[model samples]
Target: MIEIDSRAFGNKIKNIRNSKHFSLRQVSNQSKDETGVAISPSYWSLVERGKRNIPKPQTLKRIAKGLRVDESDVFRMAGLEAPTEATNLTRITSSEMVSVPIIGEIACGEPITAIENVSGHMLLPNNLVKGGDYFILKCIGKSMEPTIMNDSNVLVRAQPDVENGQIAAVLLDDDTTATLKRIKKTKNSVILMPDNPDFEPIVLNEDKPGRIIGVVKMEMKMF
Candidate 1:
């Protein structure tokens, strides 16, 4: 929701980009890992020359990271209250970036990042993540629709458990299959509830238990 003086922002971005000898194409590719958003070089060239403005803070953050420049420095050029906003959003000050693997269904029988399971990788801001194993899961099926669109990706923090009523990835079929659901633990069984009312929830009991793959941290469209 931040407004930008596009001309001034463009000059600053151009100067820094030139100093670092980065091509618009290179920056575009580098930025994909940072935000998982595809950047078009043709459009970005216009952005660098004062002809266009960055549409949102997220794109600005990606370009800043791709330039290896501290975002606060760039934010100031746009007259933004970087510190207050970044803190509130858990955005980090450090320029460090972390690459998180994008994996398919995770089952207890297979390694979390098994070569076959890993489809790709996404770069995340270091400060945005806390200590723990992290991975990106591709959303599938319509059970989680409306809340999570099919084919989108969810950032997951690998963990053994999640609180009741929280959305989590669960491994069933004796840890051979995985599914996404909102869990509710009853007195003697666990219910895997879906956001879509059309789909029925699955109930698990002591005889057939479900293992938690991880709780979802954020849902990403990757557009």
Candidate 2:
């Protein structure tokens, strides 16, 4: 991570908050991480006054959402490197945007990104997303709220599996059901854990089975 002027970052945040007419408590209460921890009002004040430390990526995202701004723009202000730029492209406002297919229902036996599976396409100006074959897959449930919203289409990088603690697009019931959840692997089983505590984790074993088709690179533009 790059060291940045805390005051400069704080000023940028304060100005945004003021522009939105949001108080410290309002932003703090409106913001929360995926784990459901909100930034405290006291800490928020300290941040605005340049007396506290910079927030993590997740915290910045929540705060930006509370401020009704793009989190990538906040990241740029803080001099933090995240996949906030370029990928935020909705319709390629710039000169370059690669068209990625939007995969609908699973064809089961057919190729993952086959034409039979594509329902639509999304244009994006992203070198990161261009690094691999990508498709848009909708997260069908509320399991990943505060990170990936319910029924939100996510940009997916085509891959067979992912490391532990990474969110993946997984197919269940022989590819008839599609869902998004964080994956955890053990010697005996594959565990699909939900970010929300309101939902229960799914443990797949001999009786229950699933196949990971891809990992979510980012949330696609909601349009």
Top candidate when judged by lDDT against the true structure: 2
Q: After superposition, how far is residue 102 of candidate 2 from its true place, in Å?
A: 1.0
RMSD (CA, Å), candidate 2 to true, equals 8.2
Point out where model 1 deviates above 4 Å. Answer: 1-95, 105-108
Candidate 2's residue-wise lDDT over 57-158, tens digit each? Answer: 777787786676877787887788766556643554555767888988878777778888889888777674766788898777777865676777888898
**Clashing residue pairs in candidate 1 (N, C-alpha, C atoms within 3 angstroms):** none
TM-score of each: 0.56, 0.64
In the range 117-168, model 1's lDDT, one tens digit per residue, is 7878878887656788888888789897645657778888889889998889
